[model samples]
Target: MNLPQSPNNAPDADDDLEPVGPRPRPKGIYALPNAITLSALFASFYAIVMAMNGRFETACIAIFAAAVLDSLDGRVARMTNTQSAFGEQMDSLADMVSFGAAPALIVYQWALKDMGKLGWIPAFVYIAGAALRLARFNVNIGVVDKRYFQGLPSPAAAALVMGLIWVVDDAGIKGVGRVDWAAWSAFAVTLFAGLSMVTNAPFYSFKVFGGRRSVPFIVLVAIALGIAVVSLDPPRVLFALFCAYGLSGYVIYGIKKSRGKPVSVIATSTDEPDEEGLHR
Candidate 1:
């Protein structure tokens, strides 16, 4: 009285069953690296808020703090074996806001605004250069040498701008209260920095951590003392120092290139290469 099986059906039904594939599940998130990235993002957001509130010095400091946090997140990820595509992209986005847009806006509002249409030009230029630098970094991540950045890093460029602002604010270099000339000069400086960020000049990528051999204790103490001094008057000291660092790369590179030296020659990274870590 049993029902007949279809012609296509196997007598041993279990034998005819297909293997069950692994079920798809949601991706697991890494907490530590993501936390660092979130902190960086918050730092950048706070910088913008401070800048808007006319707390220009605080905003600049916030941006620099964000840069420190931003630098740490990637290293932390690599050290903890938690590196991910999501973290890399997030870091770049945070950098664009903190280093790219924030500095440009701060400069524009603080000084460039007096230059009328010209004031906005440098802001746009810096932003565009930052975008290009980030895009190039992402694309060449695994292809470029890590020991040297292809161009001036965006954070350094932002630092230069903020440092200049801090110097001016601290020094109380006034008399431009309603002057177009001062505003235009600020705009011009911004434009130059923006262009420099994307230039082919080589900048020392302070990527190496604690690998230096043979430094006198006195030299170390002197460096620490210098940092302390700069901290006391960061606007004047740090700004001038970073500005010179930013410009020096271009001058050195130009001289080298004119003397028939190859611009692409750069120092190689000592660390083992990862698919995600590349510099050109």
Candidate 2:
């Protein structure tokens, strides 16, 4: 007959080890980046409030301020090594409010509201596009080429629309006959900005500048000059810059197609296990 097994036998030890479930999320989120995101969200809300009060220019400025804050939060998170899933989700939600809903509502109030029910359609379309764009971005963040965005980013699209309003308002162009033209212009820009958000065209993402990259001294000089030029005529200069950027994706797409390069913005599938379902 076989002897009885000891309490510390290998099979008993294996049985005593319980299976672990999936790891729980960290106990607390990083605060700084989320605070910045909340500030951006407040800026968006302020933009909407100012728009309602007929302070369109101030509202436009608020959107720009939100954009600046939005840009900072991600960099801050990355730099401080405090990135978290919560921060990413918060940032996207803030972006939707600031870059998507705020712009649509502001433009509608500034121009589209007077066009009857038809006036609101474009705004709704824009809101929808922004939602779709943000959702796709969240899902595809791991899959896309870091150097390029598959469609116009929502913030840039908001800039294109708000920039037009800012420049026109700065020029004091909202009287009688001018109001009608401005309204139509706002309508067109809003439509273009909204539709562009859902396009397949690839927009250049300036992600290449991050990390330990060194820059030439001339870059600093250029930045100073650019700041001075913007100071000289903030509305006109900023609007012109964003307009060019808003159209750049089509330019890049056309160039790539003409050169016989595959123009699809989707990053190619890789052999890595995590990337299996991430082709787009």
Candidate 3:
């Protein structure tokens, strides 16, 4: 034991063993899904730009475009097996801008700006709700039911607000900024969409359709007809659709409560950082 170890026969030190904590993040992120996310980010920026230029309808369209791209990025990441912490974080940030900030700013510019200091109230509330919603989503993602969302998804919330803008603008209704009714209408929509994002009510996620599960043939046919109808009148059809969806979570909550079934999509605690409450 007192003899020096021969170079070739030396015992390895503890430091020579591999480190035991989480492995280092991969050298770089995958390009494809991040690219989609970046594109969504760009669309959100473009929406803000369009809003600034008074092209509110075009801005609404860009928000919808961003939502579609947002949906694609996650699915693409999953499909390609390229999911990463970086991608998740990036997607969350993009959603904050696209669904949260952009819609608030757009609606404010289109209608709320003229209401004096009160104009900023709804906008601030909306952005705050979106932030809270996204943060909770990150914390609860691992514990929530895959088939349902614990609250109204940010994308759908954006659609609800932007859909209103699109419909009003498409109707060629002018000078909404000067019209109290129009401004109040935007006020109501922004408030509803914003608050819905933070609620514990369950909203169907439609992820059930993503698997190898088979459905009735008529389901596909109905989807095709739905597409055709939307094509016939995008602004109205889309606005109406989102309005129904915007209320869907509360409807689901009511139904579940009536049946004495658990209404929350959260399977465990929803408290930040460490789920503890198993939200009701």
Candidate 4:
């Protein structure tokens, strides 16, 4: 005879179920973009090593390579729909190494070091500026204007400074003698690049050139010509181009101000640093 089942003695339907604990946290990361960022970081590290070896020319080239790879990673992530917060932060860190620390160190070693205390000061200033700029950009990415950067981008700033070094080195103008005006020029450019990163000047982003936007055939031709020019004299041509771009923000800002148009780079509804003055 079977015993009658009491409510307390009954087998529960949930007997086979495992007790639910806190869910295991996610540990996966997207690989492709991070790999690219890592490569860029290595390029920067290589630059530093080359600089240490007194291979200044090779160091400068490595920094440029890092810049190119840095530029590509983000676009690749976007195009592949692999965007992640991890990727973004990784990119920023890689950029700091490639564009911020590497350039400052290379320039200091190549030219500024000869100036003694004066040398390290400008290098420090540039490194600090790059740090602040990267921090600000990370915070402002969502709110800032898509078409303009709030200040000179750290990469472009690095390019300007490093490009000068590369050009001078290529020209065999070692900043070591009474004729080393090139060293003085490097000093000035380092200071300028450092200061520019923290300014309110709006630099065109060129983001519009990406995506599915169509361009005239002349644009392609212009791009081809640009590549050809860069190939002809990498150091001189690239430095000149970056130098012009570094100055362009000021010109654009001046034009907008004269026209009584808004000059703020941030597009948010909140008050930006130059917004009030722009309106006035």
Which candidate's TM-score is highest? 3
lDDT by residue for model 1 (1-280), tens: 9878787764676866855887744456678988988887798788778877777778888888888888888878878878776887788898898888888888887887766786778999999999998997787666565656778889888888887777666666653426566566667777878898787777767555344346667877888999899878777777777888788777767886789875663344536465323333
Error at 22, model 4, angstroms:
22
Candidate 4 C-alpha lDDT tens digits along 94-207: 888888899999888888887889888889999999999999898778878798888899989999998888887888765442346877888899999998998888899898
Report, for every candidate in turn, its global Cα lDDT versus the true structure. Answer: 0.77, 0.87, 0.89, 0.86
Model 1 ranges off by over 4 Å: 1-27, 173-181, 211-222, 265-280
For residues 1-280, write the lDDT of model 2, one tens digit per residue: 9889777664865666876888765656998999999999999999999988889899999999999999999999989988998898899989999999999999988888888798888898899999999998887887677889978999999988889889988887664123787888887888888889988788999877646787788987888999999999999899999899989999998998899886666675567677654443
Superposition error at 190 for model 3 (Å): 0.3
Q: What lDDT is obtained when candidate 2 is compared to the true structure?
A: 0.87
Task: List the lowest-lDDT window of 10 residues for candidate 2.
Answer: 172-181
Candidate 1 accuracy as lDDT = 0.77
- Which candidate, 1 or 2, has the higher TM-score? 2
Off by over 4 Å in 4: 1-27, 175-179, 271-280
Residue 79 miss distance in model 4 (angstroms): 1.6
- By lDDT, who's the top model here? 3
Model 3 deviation from native, Cα RMSD in Å: 3.8
Estimate the TM-score of every prediction.
Answer: 0.78, 0.87, 0.89, 0.86
Q: Which of 3 and 4 is ahead in lDDT?
A: 3
| Error at 46, model 4, angstroms | 0.5
- Scanning candidate 1 in windows of ten residues, the lowest lDDT window is 271-280
Better of 2 and 3 by lDDT: 3
